[model samples]
Target: MNILVLCTGNSARSILGEAIFNQLGAGRVRAYSAGSRPKGVPHPGALRLLERRGIDTNSFRSKSWHEFTGPDAPPIDIAITVCGNAAGEACPVFPGTPIRAHWGLPDPADVDGSKAEVDAAFEATWLALTARVAAFLALPFEKLDPRELADHLAEFGRMEGAA
Candidate 1:
């Protein structure tokens, strides 16, 4: 499966989701992330958090969803929105008519506090997204029809830390 995660900024939550999905899914799925309005850089806090967990941070960047519109772009099987702003905006049509779901999450970049507090917020977001991704990875995707898969994914959106 190929999944695309989206957020307005694509700097924090969506980036985190992308890393988690790629890390956990490995050979089962390929995950990418983008923004409606690209921030041009991944959030530093997000980068630091992923680095702490030993996930490769070299490939991450804040990119526009428009990049996936080309014929050469990888077809997406699913598209998930991780922030309310991006979830509410109209997204570009992905190549494969990917299933869509919203897993609204608080943007760790929006958190305001000491450095530790900010890092903690990023850690919490990472944990929540990881839980959701693990649940998704546990599903019998090969056997489930699109409708069943969509329903299960929707349920995953309601897990802890849902925004």
Candidate 2:
């Protein structure tokens, strides 16, 4: 399945999500991430966190959702919003009418104070996203109908760290 993760900035949570899903999906799922209003760069803290997890940070970038709206865009099987802002905002129409869900998370970039504190916030975000993504991968994708799949996706949003 091709999955898309979204957020307002696309720099932190969504970027981390793309990395985690791609890493953990083990070839069963392909994931991408975009933002409503991109910040033009991935957050430094997010990159640091992903690198610590052994994810190649070079492939991730902050991009706009418009990239997925074109006829030539990759067909997205699912779209997940990782922040409350993106969840409530207007989004581009995906090419394949992908299943949608909101896995709201607090923006780790919004955390203030020392470097250690900032890293801690990003770590927490990573843990929460990891849990939700693991739950998604555990689903019986081959047997579940579209409605059932969407229902299962929605339940992932309500897991720990829900915003």
Candidate 3:
């Protein structure tokens, strides 16, 4: 399965979700991320947390959702929105009917504190997103129909850290 994680900024939460999904999904799913308004680069705190976890930050960059609009873009089987703004915005998770789920989270980049506190907020966001991604990776995707899969994804959105 191919998945796309979306957020307004694509700087923090969406980036974290992308990493978590890609790492845990292994070769079972290909995950990508984008934003309604690209931030150009990822948030420093997010990059820090990812690097600390030994996940390569070199391939990550804040990008627009339009990049996936081209005919050459990979087909998305699922599209997850991690923030309200992107969830509400017009998304092009097209070419087919892809399951959509919202896993809204408070932006760690919006946290105000010293280095440690800021890093802690990022860590918390990471953990929350990790939980949802891991749950999806654990599901028996081959058996579930589209409706069942959608229901499960919606249930996951209501888990901890839900906004």
**Per-candidate clashes, comma-separated:** 0, 0, 0
> What does candidate 2's lDDT look like per residue over 119-141, in tens digits?
99999999999999999899878
After superposition, candidate 2 runs with Cα above 4 Å error: none
Clashes of 2: 0
Candidates in descending lDDT order: 1, 2, 3
Give the clashing pairs for model 3: none
Each candidate's TM vs. the true structure?
Answer: 0.98, 0.98, 0.97
TM-score of model number 1: 0.98
